[model samples]
Target: MNRNKDKAWYIADVGDDLIYIAEKLNTKANSEDYHFENELLMLKEVLETLESLECLKEHSE
Candidate 1:
């Protein structure tokens, strides 16, 4: 098995997980809950980074 492909798949999986968490947070968050907003933002940033990594991995193949 190609390690790079495996790594890319893992990254994509994590990104999907982050997206799910973000969706849940959005549904459960209220206007007063700044913490939830912050968490969602952080998740978005991490997901973006993971997407970039996946793109690079594909290009390197």
Candidate 2:
């Protein structure tokens, strides 16, 4: 098992929540929404990176 599995899952959960909130708002009509969108994007990247690391750890073990 990946040592960071818990952390990875937590980050992914947060990212999912952010994405859901952004989608629910769907504030693309307003420029202010860009900030949330950008944050969601960054969080997605973090989630992906953590997931990848977790995969690597699993494979190594």
Model 1 segments more than 4 A misplaced: 30-61
Candidate 2 residue-wise lDDT, 1-61, digit = tens: 4556865686667678777666655766454544455656766776787777678778878
Best by lDDT: 1
Worst 10 residues of 2 by lDDT: 28-37
Per-model RMSD to reference: 3.7, 4.7
Candidate 2 regions off by >4 Å? 1-34
lDDT by candidate, in order shown: 0.73, 0.66
Candidate 1 lDDT (Cα, 0 to 1):
0.73
Query: Tens digit of lDDT per residue, candidate 1, span 1-61?
Result: 5867877676778778787876777766654554666666777777787777778768977
Q: Which TM-score value belongs to model 2?
A: 0.44
How far is 18's C-alpha from truth in model 1 (Å)? 0.4
Please give the lDDT score at residue 55 for candidate 2.
Answer: 80
